[model samples]
Target: MPFRTSGPAASRASLPSRAAGRLARTTWVDLVVAAAVLVLLYLTLRVGQGTTVRFSTSQSAKVDTDPARLPYDAARSLLRMFVALAASVVFTFVYAYTAARSRRLERILIPALDILQSVPVLGFLTVAVSGFIALFPGSMLGLECASIFAIFTSQAWNMTFGFYYSLTAMPRELDELSRSLRFTRWMRFWKVELPSGAISLVWNGMMSFGGGWFFLVASEAISVNNKDYALPGVGSYAGAAIADGDLGKVGWAILTMAVMVIGVNFLFWRPLTAWAEKFKNEQSEATEVQRSYVLDLLRRSHWPRLLGYVLRPVGRGLGRAARILGTDDRPLTHDPARQRTGDIAFAVVAGGLILWGLAGLAEYLHDTSGLGVFGEPLLLGLATLGRVLLLVAAATVVWVPIGVRIGFSPKLTRIAQPVIQVLASFPANFLFPLAVWFFLRTGLSIDVGGILLMALGAQWYILFNTIAGAMSIPTDLREAMDDLGVHGWQRWRRLILPGIFPSYVTGGITASGGAWNASIVAEVVTFGGTTLTATGLGAYIAQATAGGDFPRLIAGVAVMSLYVVALNRLLWRRLYRLAETRYTL
Candidate 1:
């Protein structure tokens, strides 16, 4: 038999089967749920439509750098990161879920998302600050919201991508089981698919959260109309210190960020990792199960039980609501002509809008800088592309082995999570001195320095994702390999590498995106009045940013986005197909 191409719908059952489409059970809980669902839908409709908030950022922002305020600053940054992370989760659920459900939407949405995430945090920050400040005139809430939104952009994309892949690449048997269960879409989502993707979501979410900290300076420090604004956070404090050329204050800020990152990992991510281990897709439980001290403590407490008891009614109500809503499993009529027509319409509208935006950009560039501006950035982009490819490949070589060891050992994972997260969350600006020192001492150019700087912030994407993938390999599969006398290189070749290939691809793509963004800051280095610039797209963007040349910035960003998306489509996608065919869980 010829090789088969398994599309997303081939292995997943978010669709209604004949039995489920016919009838479902009824109860008072169901009635109450139905009523609640109606109320929710009404509220959603009322809130879904846009309401304009006035945009203004005339208010001057400042940060106080008292060491006494370190705790407060750390708290603010942590709060923003977590809040943004929460929002990212909601966005991932809504955005990725919708895209996954509809092939028409997926075609447009996925590509758009690739472009969106490729936009640098600074690019987003520039536009968001003014709008958010205007929305909440005379209130600090605007600045806070702006910071949170910037962090959201940093954190959401990786998570959304991971979840989208997980949904589509679900195992064939599980998809069949879901359809056979007579599940309505809601039931399918909550009971089957959601649980299925839980591991990927949690792990990827953890990575995104860590990556958000990499852009803390960009998020917390703002500049508009030649005016500098700094939010009261560790990031802004560090930025201020760097500006003042005070290494002491910078060191203190690094300490604060490290504490915040490691503490959150212990309290939040480790516990989630331990909890999500139960959801692993395997017939036999792993011999070494992940454990977390925080989770163990919580389990040993009465608080969780009490809370569960208190929220039992709410849980029941939601379950009932899902049952009632899902009972209507009537499948939509599949009219090929109409479907094709709708797809064409969607493409036309989406393509027209994109082209319109591009045309506007081109017109602006033509008027101000001329279309010739694109030439340098394209050449610079190729330089950056080489660096990015090398970064991903090198990081993969370094992290994969370590990630495997960490993921396969429950104790080691629990211990390493905080340490790894702290390292990942460390901002590159704080380490500029080290890069500069090495460059000066070794006589290496900014080319090598660019790679070093890019790796500082982006390597964790590969490490954390590889760990997630390694942990998810089925226990039964391992045992089967062992029983078949598979060992050492053969075991790795046949099982380990293939099992983690999908996750590695996910990690590699996100890491590449992070590296591209990091390049803007990485390629152009300045510390102690010594500035070193690499000849790359990143250097062009950095110089444009410094000069406050909006046109150059736009061109650089556009070109950079094009490069990132091209890499994603041309390279990572083939690995995605391989994972789908050979290693899907």
Candidate 2:
């Protein structure tokens, strides 16, 4: 048999002859989902439009952080969130590329990333605020940037991890195709790696957006060492409410959050998901097309038309550039100029960081006490890191097996799916009262309280991803394993485990990041504040808020971000590499 080849035009075409059949099957499936989402959006938007919401007056102090601008604050917070999300995507792209292709680079990068991610949100707040404030002296822009950065801390890790997961878990066939073609790294990345990974990354982005909202109150409102810089945002308002124990305000806030989430899902995420599904290579015959009024309206609008016009030119330019850069199927001589440019960029960043470190050292020498405060947060971050690691590891072990088994059995998956969704949807705040009561009765430590909070927030990522991963395992693999007489432990160890490794990692990393958000609430509690605090990053943040210390809080957030970045670079990167090399089919 002679080798078969497609024409260049055919290769670049968006849809193939086989695609029509797949579309026929899937179009109706997504149409139904789109319709339901539209209905949900209508109800949420109608209910959320009014200024009046059910609230109690007894908790006025808690919700009074920016009493004069409640609605404005909420709007601002939402806008800032979008801004942070944009920044997060850019940052993720940069970091993912740096760590994915190069092993030697990854070794240094991953550990540093781990420390950044592990450090608490407060650690960053403490260090960054003064600097940001200094950058644009006497301007709200600096304050705004600080607040947005806080939101970024919550949102960025999950998105970055999503990209990382997609990059590492690329299908073996795709990897082989790229390798056989001898495609330049950029070509393989732009055409194959990115497109294949996009669905999962988009899904992660949607989830992370919601998760980011949950942390908005904590991130926007700064409290450190007894000094409070209550930025005008939803978070500051919510934090105030928590502090004052206002049930009505809390209820109102929760309602607002729900409405926003529902609206965002319908308007943005739902359509994107539906469209992304259309790109899948296979679809169940039973699947259907989705109908979306918003999308229908938008499809006829001028915006997409304008976007098409703009992007057409850019796409052409990029194509030409790729060719010029030697991204053809056959190998080409490496470009010394491009390599040198990259080296120069790296050198600049290194030099800038060195200067920053030197300046910090000089300042610390002037006031030894300043260095001592930073050390305190470092220790607190470490304690928090330990708590997060223990809980995340424990959750993974418990959830992976259960999720995989449920996934393998359709009936079980169907029965368990709704229950799992509900559990995951339940807010950590809902569990706090019970957690607090249980601890009070037992006179338990804050460390235990913090762990429980972190666990509750983080566990679902592992559970959900594991289920998705396991269910997505190719049917051919299942048959092959059965034919080989693989069963019980052997089947799981050899088949199920490897199949779901990517999902497990996705869950673990997201959960680890969620732990950071959960810590602030976990370590610092106020049920009329008989004022119990833990010896962790969360406690440090809570105490700082109480004491009104902003510098310490920023310091804490910095340490936390550093930890998270370091962890991903170290643990997550290693696991990703293992998956790509060892278990990949």
Candidate 3:
């Protein structure tokens, strides 16, 4: 048969048959998914209305052991994570873009970001809880909001750094091309800058999620002014179980968390990773695009086709609206006089505020304790710094090689990626009891145990970034090295280490900051009525917070922040500049 031979009658005749074929191809899975979605919507509504379960402040502090309740608890916890992730994304775009684009903003914003990143997750909770509680007095929603914000604090900073770094480090050719095209700031952001930064942003988002989990337990089981305000989630459940010394419940919580983390990676992050590869500026000749079965299934499904058809008009309308929103047409130009005046004014204002804040804090400390009180906290800061350096050094030695090996092999990466993500997401605090037991049994010092705990939380930053860097190495370069008979330590020293150095620096910076934050929890761990205290800034901060000694806590936090900012300025910033100029691939 000659198929359709271009006749109107022939096309009309084919329409019915095409429609019948489509109908015949509809599967049971689609129907099942539709039903499941409906049931989920119903459940969500019920949960929101507090009809199915009450997540009240009073009830949130208790631990429930009924296996059947685990699903609801898990759902509540995951909801907070998703909400916080959404907030983090919004924050990353605004904060990172603003800092990256404007040199004037960068001066203030970059330093502010560093300080914020160094501030402990617990510090955010302490500050946020009281305000949130006052805002929504005696309501569960306020507590939930505060918990989500705490998680946001944990997740936002590193993701912001990733985006800003990516934007600043964009290839010169791409920048020239965008300028040649005469792209407005908005157009350049949409068409060039955002796409260029997408891969790094996605990878960092995954890492941020892991950090969110690390703090979720503490955030959920919060105490403000010695008053417990536990929210109904797996975190609070685990915290209560640990407090009550219920090993069985702890095991169950661990299992549930494991399942949830694995499921999320498969359902969300895996697909995102595969999708973001298309946005890479330079695609290697032999680099295989990462694949996700979930993504493939969605592509092949009829639902996506129908949804796209339905949303096409809406998308076009939005595009029109975007174009109507005015973009800056003038080319960017430097105004030395204006810039200098702005800088001077900003410095004056900022210096005044800082001096005023410091004076207030000093007076407060003097009135309560004495000027000499800062001496102990400053000494503690040094002790914590030593532990951080040791842990970061050990972690880099162990994880970088393993990350490179896994990243260079696609088969290995596919097999190991999800597993590593799951491990990274596992809360380090959940294992505190086991760590304490080991320390007691071996008669190891609490200081060593605390360092190990901090390392467990922070080491993944190095490993994940190393893998990302390694995987990005061009295939042609690898092949060229192979043809030259490059192998073993020689290959690593010349090829891999240099290739991954920039990423290693990025990871190290974040990991160092994270270790500082992890210290607050790690330095003062109490497991099953056994307390282990390490004498450091983290311990000082934790003890002060626990005892409601606001003056001491503020002093400890101030000292810790000073150490972090100083180290970042004197060490990491210089390293980062070197990486930007010399080591970037």
TM-score of each: 0.86, 0.70, 0.89
- Put down candidate 2 lDDT per residue, 24-65, tens digits, no spaces: 554543566557669857754553343123322122223354
**TM-score of decoy 3:** 0.89
Clashing pairs in 3: none
**Candidate 1 local lDDT, 324-439, one digit each (tens):** 75432123347788777988998899899989988998898899989998888999899999999999999989999999888878889878888888888888887877777789
Which segments of model 3 are wrong by more than 4 Å? 1-43, 50-60, 302-332
* Poorest 10 consecutive residues by lDDT, candidate 2: 51-60
- Best candidate per TM-score, number? 3
Error of 1 at 88 (Å): 0.6
Clashing residue pairs in candidate 1 (N, C-alpha, C atoms within 3 angstroms): 54-134, 55-134, 56-134
Candidate 1 yields a Cα-based lDDT of 0.81
Model 2 TM-score relative to the real fold:
0.70
Whose lDDT is higher: candidate 2's or candidate 3's?
3
Q: Model 2, residue 426: what's the lDDT?
A: 39
